[model samples]
Target chain A: MLLNQFLLLSALLFAMGVYGVLTRRNGVLVLMSVELILNAVNINLVAFGAFQDNVQGDVFAIFVIAVAAAEVGVGLAMVLLMYRNRRSIDFTEVDLMKG
Target chain B: MTSALLLAQVEFDVAQNIAFAIIAAIMLISAFKMVTTGNVVHAALYLVIVLAASAAIFILLGSDFVGATQVLVYIGAIIVLFLFGIMLTKAQLGDDDSVEKEQRSMGALVGLLLFVVMAFALIDTFGTQEIEFGNPEPIAYVAEPVDANDLPTPVREALNISANSGTVEISEAQFATLLPEVQRRVPGAEVRGNNAQIADAIFSQYIIPFEAVSVLLLAALIGAVVVARKE
Candidate 1:
């Protein structure tokens, strides 16, 4: 497969993720968007690694996956905490820091 | 060397293109649904499909280990955590259809802009460049002792080396200087499989980062526990 095809896929996924993060009211959905972005990045990394003959890209992807796991773990926990405190996970509703 | 081999390569390329197209479509559609679905649970499930398709794409890219890790970590652990979070948060899992109507058009416009910029950049940089199959050539300027046992199965087979073949130390500089002579006497050097080389890289060159990631994971685990636990 062409590298550009993978790149295009990554770009589209990233855009979708961005849209999700920007517009989604639910905090959990926001985290899912972030996961989408990260997954797109993983595709880019693995594709480049495979095409360019570099194992570093794959190694970095491993780290990315681990980090993403941790991120989602913490993110979901935060969402849970927010829900416990506010009884709602909507981003607009949880705006206590609003000036 | 024969027309049969050439035909096989062409068929392989066609198969790869078809796989890429189908997987890309699946990932894009599911990702779109993941963001736009009214039910948070359904969105998460769509994310699972997207992630699973991504893992398939990784497998197609020949990084089998990374693909497996994606499935294990992303689908198995991360999405499940998202589901648990949704359930704990009492998110309306039903088709209430109030996911998000606020700022939808603005977000889509921004996303479209970003996509255009990224697509242009990507096309400008790597237009229609296909990823070559088979093994990647060895890294330059690194002297490594190679043994048949140390070689990956594909590489060993390609090099036609026995299991007990003695170690041969070859540096990039030495290879370059002796290229013409070596080419006359021997076939090309064996290129290790992605899994083998990745293992070598992580344990050798990237060991510190690997350890650091472990520490990071531990900290995240503890931090998540502390944050989510009720007082």
Candidate 2:
């Protein structure tokens, strides 16, 4: 019962995150969606860790969190730099790199 | 007869199932809101809800340690970073009319299709099985009593055993027992003293990744400092 519930919720969250990543023009919202995806993955990790009676998955989840923190740090810095240059945070508008 | 036997073998607890259903519902709804909401700050707040729900699910799954870590690290630290990013970037506080509606509609369709496919895959994989929850076997080594002759007399005496009595050894089992009691008394009990197997695996096999995490943290600190540096 619990595993099914968790799996369903994780799928839903990941789907919502995909929608946000694809549809949202704002870079900040895209970052938030990325976090959503990461959270969904973490839920799956912890659930399976508990089910399989293994702590290694939980440990890996912790590593994922660390990597996520680093990713958000670098990603947000880049987003801020783009916002500074373009005066807009929308991805549609920040196509200066596109040839 | 086989179907009936299978049905009898599967035990579903109503209360737990209902509770999990509620938590799952809240998680999905909050996540949907987090993505769909037009306001950035509102989206962050909804993300907090989603994280909290995931943590709750973690606790329900019997990994209290990972669940608490999820709440503390993701909700407390990472979301704060996101909010800071929004502030630093000075994102428009209101919804913009210039966003492409047709693209968003297409993306929603794609997302919905992906959701259905993933859901079907999960159901196909796990639908026939029953999930049972209980205390897992401790990964630490379990100690068994050694022969009386193997232990020194004094050590045997301290364990309230006669020279003829089997040696009551203090091995991984003894440490495992003591560690949980200590954890109950002392908050944030480190797993170092209790589980030697875990320690060995972490220090020997995972050492590189551990150091890499530290390096990543260092990089993040420097990056944040550079980004936040005053012009």
Candidate 3:
């Protein structure tokens, strides 16, 4: 397959993720969008890795996945806190120190 | 055994492209629904589909190990975490329905701009470069297991394979010239990453970063437990 296809797909997916992050009111939904963005990055890395016949792309993809997992863990912990104290996952209402 | 560039041409693209099309369609739909679905659980399920499709793409590209890790980590662990978060949160999202709708148009506009720029750049810069990966077959034409130690010093060093690595890949033409007493061409699967090379890379060039990642994962694990602990 042409490299363009994969690149275009990642780009489109990334845009959707951007939209999700910007529009989602629910905090979990926003996090989900972030996952979309991360996955798009992964596709790009893997595609480029395959394209260049280098294993470094795969290595970076692995690292990105590891970091993303940690990020989601920490992110969800924060989300849990938000839900606990606020009783709502609507991030727009999270103005505890917005002064 | 007669060994003279044993060749069978395999048509590489037809079914592969079709499969890619079908899988990519499923992925795109799931990704769209994931971000747009109002129900949190439904959104998570959509994410599962999207992630699984991503795994399929990875496998299609011959990075099976990466694909498997994607399924296990993203779908298995991360989505489960999202589900747990959903179940724990009261998730009262209706109070600001109007606000969600209002912001969505602006989001759409920005998303469109990003897409346009990205797609244009991609299509223009990499118009038709085919993904070059995975040799058609491994070169093994030795009548017997060619011991890495037995090969002459120069050839051994040139092959750069240690005796213990077991799996050796060298072009029959190349190998014949270097160590001419070879027998048959071993024709089978392509010589791409099947986790072995990835392991090699991780342990060799990326050792420090791999160790650092493990430490980071540990930190995240402890931090998660501590933060979730009630005061």
Most accurate candidate by TM-score? 1
Q: By TM-score, highest first, what's the ranking? A: 1, 3, 2
* Residue B207 error, candidate 3, Å: 0.9
Worst 10 residues of 1 chain B by lDDT: B179-188
TM-score of chain A of 1: 0.94
Each candidate's fnat, listed in order, reads 0.92, 0.58, 0.81
- Candidate with top DockQ is 1
The CAPRI quality class of candidate 3 comes to medium
Candidate 2 ranges beyond 4 A from true positions:
B1-12, B136-201, B227-231
**Which 10 consecutive positions of candidate 3 chain B have the poorest summed lDDT?**
B180-189
Worst 10 residues of 2 chain A by lDDT: A49-58
Task: Estimate candidate 1's RMSD in Å.
Answer: 6.7
lDDT of 2 by residue, B1-231 (tens): 999866654544666667788888888888888887778899999999888888888777766766777888888998998899889788876874455789889889988998899899988887745456653343444345566666544444444447676545555433444434332222222334213433554577888998989999899879966874657
- The DockQ figures for the candidates are 0.80, 0.56, 0.79
Model 3, A1-99: lDDT tens per residue?
Answer: 788888888898999999999988788889999999999999999999889877787888999999999999988998898888878788888877998
Model 1 per-residue lDDT tens digits across residues B1-231? 699998998998899889888988888988988888889889989999999999999899888999999999988888879888888888887764554455898899999999999999999999988898764444334456776576555444444567797886544554555443242332245545678889999999999999999999999999999999999
Model 3 lDDT, residue B157, Cα: 57
